[model samples]
Target chain A: MSTPSSEQEVHEHGVTEAVISYPQFLWKALGVATDGNALFYVWMTALTAVWLVGINAFAHQIVQGQGLTAMTDHVSWGMYIGNFTFAVGLAAGAVMMVIPAYLYHDEDMHDVVIVGEILAIAAVAVALAFVNVDIGRIDRLWHIIPFIGRFNFPVSMLTWDIIVLPGYFLINLHVVGYLLYMRFLGRKPNPKWYIPVVLLSIVWAVSIHTVTAFLYSGLGGRPFWNSAILAPRFVVSAFVSGPAFIVLALQIVRRFSDFYVGHKPIVTLINILRITAVVNLFLVGAEVFTEFYTGGSHVAAAEYLYFGLHGKNALVPWIWTAVVCNVVAAGIFLTVDPRKNLWIIDVACVMTLFGLWVEKGLGLIVPGFVPSTLHEVVEYLPNALEWKISLGIWALGLIIFTLGLKIAVAVFTGTMHVDAAHDAGEV
Target chain B: MSDPSRRTMLKGAGATLGAAAFARAVAPITEWTNDLSVEGFLQKHYKELTVEDMSAVLARIERETEEQYGAKVSVEDVRPTPGVQFAYALNLSVCIGCRRCAKACHEENNHDRATNNSYIRVLEMTNGSLNLEHGTVTYDHAVPAPGKFYMPVQCHQCDNAPCVRVCPVEATWKESDGIVVVDYDWCIGCRYCEAACPYHARRFNWSKPEIPADEINPDQAYLSNRIRPQGVMEKCTFCLHRTRRGKLPACLEACPTGARVFGNLADPDSEIRWVLENKRVFVLKEDLGTQPRFFYFFDE
Candidate 1:
């Protein structure tokens, strides 16, 4: 909570002026949530309301059993797992920004990269929450802990996922917490503080999405997800959607907060989207070609995805829509200059976000089960209750993100000034 | 900052309502706890349990089943004898798609009556092709229809069990006797095993399995067919309760055409070994390298 006279004066202070102490910083961070702004209060209340509704539904599902979901013997997993997959990609995508900021020393991206990190924190939390809800017994969750319950390590891809997800979460949490705390205390963060940790985070980011892909690819029974290209496809598409989300988030932050986000980071993010979208599309095309051109026993799953398999074509329209959105968004991003025409960039970002949502979220998971083992075709669609429960988890993530971002802005812009009494160590 | 008194009163009211709502949300958990015994809740993992602990757990399960299902069931932890590796052989040439095997499995394993859940899915394929894609499992016509062949698929009980490898918790495993079994109490019901099976052989309890007290299979095993909880996975255990006790599986006994064969593969003179050595026999999806003990063959 230390302000210079002007934006130029802020630079003159060299990001190390001692205008706030450690205790004051904690107080200010906590106080950010208590703002009297009607809009802030309304948004928080709405999120809490949605979360409560979701909890109620979850309780019902737990009591009555997963029969409330649309899943059957043919399709064991549904929207909960689909959303969990999407959230993992989102959490991993923060590394795309972190790499350029730290490794390449992109001066423009250095300050604003924390926004992506904050998003990753929220996304990871939501992903874990979805898994918790997806499991049949919440009371028995202690089984996954080492020693307490026998963990199937080294062999189970799910055990690998369980290890890596929270590992990545803790790395991001520690790195972000250290950097923000240092900044609030008006101290230059030691390179030792985040250097090795950030490097680990960069590799950890790639591992998270790759491990998620391996969860499907390693399953030999599900021919649709058994492709070798799935890992690359996951990473490329994560790069597309993850940056696209941050671009939209940056715009939102610009609208609401006084913290300055330069146009340069937005342009950089767009360039990333353009290249990765094309790569994502290329990988997808390769998958389709191999599936259709080979025309082997494995083609059944691909056929069911694109066309109807024995008159069960619930996902055909959804897959086609995803294809159109991805192709058009990639086309626009490749051709248009986001620097001059911001509106076009906005359109591309929205398309990329929604397109990836459909493609990776539902499109990727549902087809693997349609032509289920024994070659029966049974379509799966998320019922209304599943949607409500999913929205509730999403709302909870947004609340964490909104509150975190608010504190970040308050600290960064020096809006919450430190009092002299607090400097004097008074209670 | 202004009107602190009113703000404090609002906060108090919000706290009270939140507590009330939380209590309502947790009401079902109270019912869940009441349904489960304290002994069952505190039971250790199956492999870690001592013989006395297992007996206590089995007794607790028996009492609970009597209270819940109103059936006096005997739950035993049947162990596999040495040098006895169980195997199954199905004669495709004789199988008439009668689905008696499926029905027998539904009754023997205490499957959900509402869904008529069965581990065995008897798929009827076109006579000229072995492609499982054209197989129909819901055929309501007579047995052995013209231009059709029946293939019954169940837990292959593979040596390289993908289901066992994929479970996050080691709730399911391949026994020394070659049967893959699940600990219903230990399983978190993630259903990864259901997704892992190449045969679609696993069944999940979407709701509390409703089996009429009279219809309930009273002869139950700790590791095999028992009244499964609502959120666990269950599959065919080769009717281990009967098979380990030197009796044929109910499905094999129930088959009118004698299409099913069960024996110990370790015995050279077993009927399954004879079928394997002399008949055109193969396992389903053999290229996946699961090494299933269950084989299908056709008679000349």
Candidate 2:
């Protein structure tokens, strides 16, 4: 553990004069992750169990065929794709913390910005998993690899997604890795390495969500998604979910750990949530107005989503539940002050997260295929296997997040550092 | 040499055991991969394959078909004709609600038996409307029910096909003959093309197509009616295997009332050209600008 005198010495010297090698730092990080409290072990064990169940379901899906799922020719993409879409939004939302911390130069935000980046990494991993599971032939995935495979670049928005998503993941990994490594060495981090990358990540984050929205909107055949406002709506909704998730994460970190998260950062995040939640609701209103008011042949999907079409109304309840959640959450965010009543903020954050998941995931992707292209209404609902698989993916994501946060907290708090044995030639 | 070497050996043994355990855990994936041959996995896209490569691929497919389905199928690599482009037209007034063409497509294209799958869906619509939303494919009553008319829809083989445009791997594309086709072997089976097509023209093979060995179509073209593998996209190719060999589509020949017209649009005297010139023929959802090669005309 670092003492006051040692901390003073580090500040004065600007860098640690005696530092251990990279390997030693990594060894220490592993220790930090593995050596945790009883609660951490239990949580990790539960997550692993769920993850195994998911893998089993996915294997069964592969063996039995995608026919085991509810997807048909009419509704070709279902739970996997819907979850993939929502996870991408979550990944994009993580940049909200980055924007405030880096652009605004808020010192308090800088202390906890790593949480958002780690979440981004976890979210992207989950997104990729959803995509892998959704694929009809996961073995033939190499066909889309550029040069080695016939990648339809520039023409296909999916290709753009393939490039940006992993690109964002790598970028965040580099930033987080570099920062943690510097902190482990008790050395001052050079802005040259991480600053340019952080700036690139912000722009890359927006591009990823925009490109994802374009994947749907570019399809002129699906008039339900063929709207110009979709890209902006994706961005705005991401802002809502991202900050709401961060606020909850920050609260949890503060409650459980000894890490010093100041009041200012939470307030700053709440302020961001206030504006984004309203803007998200406004975008939803605008989309609903345009879809219903026009009442054209294209309105069949929207009608199916909101008011039910003919006799089938599978999605009507889902959209309304999302609407109620968003409205209530946004109202709470606008009125309640986080300083006085913290539980209210937690409630609101959970609501917004759930609301946005439904809004962006099933509420968006399913409707595009309902009242399918030839005007036949073939409703899709994700079966039990799909739910089990989805739960497993979420568990995998939480595992990543938990392990990442543990290492980050350890490094940031000066509890994990390079062993002095490295300098003594014993390592 | 003493303690450290012993520890290292034990670590190696532990790693091997762990790897073996992991492999056993994922035994289902290993079992699934047994059906996928190394040659099939490494095969190139349809357009990129040379003559030798195509013949080899076609032979591989034939061998696989024989082995898997116990059927002796002849799969060929058929190319487009130099001076011909195909077009189809349907006489809406004459078309009865009976789905003989749909049935012919199912049998001719070697569709899955359990799903009773076909490229064509005959929508029974009310007489006073052209709106497809009001149309129903679930009608079970007698043929040509008094106030109802039927419209059979399939792949239009559109010149500007949304299905072709949205395919992330160029697995589906428009041939030089203006017919949209899918290289079923190359498709990643993301089904993006299925969602992109307004006609719902594309079908995904959710499971292994379960056609009996005796019922399998022996004359198969690699791009047209060859039975697709599970987890790929397939669509109507104007029965190009038959069409390129100077024959009409299976659906056209199967139509009871001569409602379907198929011919080379490049030929000035073709029947499809005469229909387009003489009748008020229109493409479905023309405002989307897909420029479909299939047309419909009502006898007024």
Candidate 3:
């Protein structure tokens, strides 16, 4: 709430000049997040219920052992690791907005770029949660701590992941937190404070996803993942899924709130998706050609994924579904214009999101181990408990994203400034 | 507009409910943690342990094994002998696919009785084909069924071990005697090593291993046959508990067909060396350049 004079000032200058201390800013942000409309309450409640169920299931997993999941020694890394890989791409994909907004100095993108950064933070949190749940010894997690634990640095790709994923999370958090705090204080954010970090985040985003791809590709034992093009495919497909998610998110934000998100940013995202989706398809085609054409013992896993190996084709349908979804989505993005046919863009975006989820999550990870290294065919599908844990992680991420957006919207719309409560005589 | 005291009471109630829910959500982790000891949680890596630290660790393990499995076990920290690098030579010509080697590994390593877990997997391949991709591990009819030759595979303990390289915590490493060993206490059980292993030699403890009291192997090495905690990776250490003490590996000793030969590679007169010199010998997946200490040979 604000008095007439302060409200006029906000209308004229887009902000009040009054600044608050850091702790006060955080306290006010928390207040803004907690205080929301009825829809916010319903959404929060739903997410909380799912998250609690997931937590209980995870606790059950911990008590019972990882054996409760469908994972075996043959397919040791399963849905948990699959979801982790996909979420890392989502986090990295959030940098797409950053590239246009910060690097190219696009004004429309700059206004909505904070939304992408917030999504990155939430995505990284989800990625870390999946990793935590997947590990066998959650209690012994301290063993990977760099100083105290015997961290096998410079050798283990996982250790590299441990470094980059958290590093990306912190970088995005710092950028988003600083910008929001400054906005809440009604002050113009200094370019020097966040510019370098923003630039670093763009590079760091690519590194996080690349590191994740390398985690699979670096393993020589699994020939399905031992390709040089895996990292490229990861980055390119991230571009597809990342922009698709942002497009859907931005539409939701525009519909729900009074924040002035123009069609320009949505068009920008669609344009990115158009190119990346095709490139992603090209990479897939290239990889498929390389695998099938070579046709050796190394092709066993790919054969199992695409055309069922030895009467055990659990993943064949899944891969084909991804291919169809991706091809159809790319076609829509290439032909349909978001300016006239906005609903069609939404459809295409959802399709790509599902397509990339299947492609990156199950289609990629499962095949790498289906025909085990010793040529034994052992198919894996995530059981009910694994699905519960994954859904819970998604719910937790949504909770973080929703709360973050609520606070950001309040600050961006000039409703929760430093001196507004004081001016309204409510302090 | 609302009453302040009533609002405070409501806030307190909400906080209490939240705490209860959080505690319930984390109950499994807490219950799991109850089995973990502070000393065990803080135990140093195998390479970092001092003589005193190792002795204390061994004592702690023995105590824990007694408490958990109800089996009185002697856990020893066996050091590798100098100038003695172990190599295994299996005579493919004599192997009949009885899977006695796998059974021997199960008993010798104190594997879970439910899974019948073992470090070795014996594949029955068609007579003319050397491709492991064509091999099958689940054949049930009989010993070396007609037109099939048996090949038993286990950890190669490679000079360039991918499992060792990929471990995020350095929990597994190759020792001086050309044997790869895992410090089960230190492994975070990410199973990255399991995925990196081409041999499918590594096994994971899906749950607490079940062994009857009388059947439990009492003679254990801290890094070898001792019962591993749930959710860690274990593999063949070439029976280092016995081999380091100048004894044969249980798998080699149990071979009724004399199919397996083991000895110090450094000793020129060793039987393994003689097999390598006299017979046509090869390592599995040699093109991967794992430089395996384990070899297979066939007589003409």
TM-score of chain A of each: 0.92, 0.94, 0.93
The candidate scoring highest on DockQ is 3
lDDT by residue (A127-203, candidate 3, tens digit) is 99999999888888999999999999999999999999999999999999889887776668888989999999999
- Using TM-score, give the best candidate's number: 3
lDDT of 2: 0.89
List lDDT for all candidates, in order: 0.87, 0.89, 0.90
Q: What is the Cα-based lDDT of residue A30 in candidate 1?
A: 73
Distance from true location, Cα of A60 in model 2, Å: 1.3
User: By DockQ, is 2 or 3 better?
Assistant: 3
Winner of 1 and 3 under TM-score? 3
Report the C-alpha lDDT of model 3 over B131-181, residue by residue, as the tens digit. Answer: 998899999996868899999999999999999999999999999999999
lDDT of 2 by residue, A1-427 (tens): 6999877875555333333267677787776665556687678768877887788789888876899899999989988898888899899999989988999999999999999999999999999999999888888899888888988888988999999999999999999999998888766889998999999999999999999999999998899999999999999998888889989999889988878889888899889999999999999899989989999888899999999888999988888988999999999999997999879989989988998899898899999998888888999999999998999999999989988998999989889876554445321
User: In model 2, which residue pairs have backbone atoms overlapping below 3 Å?
Assistant: none
Ranking of all candidate structures by their lDDT, best first: 3, 2, 1
Model 3 misplacement above 4 A: A1-20, A420-427, B1-16
User: On a 0 to 1 TM-score scale, where does candidate 1 land against the true structure?
Assistant: 0.94
Ranking by TM-score: 3, 1, 2
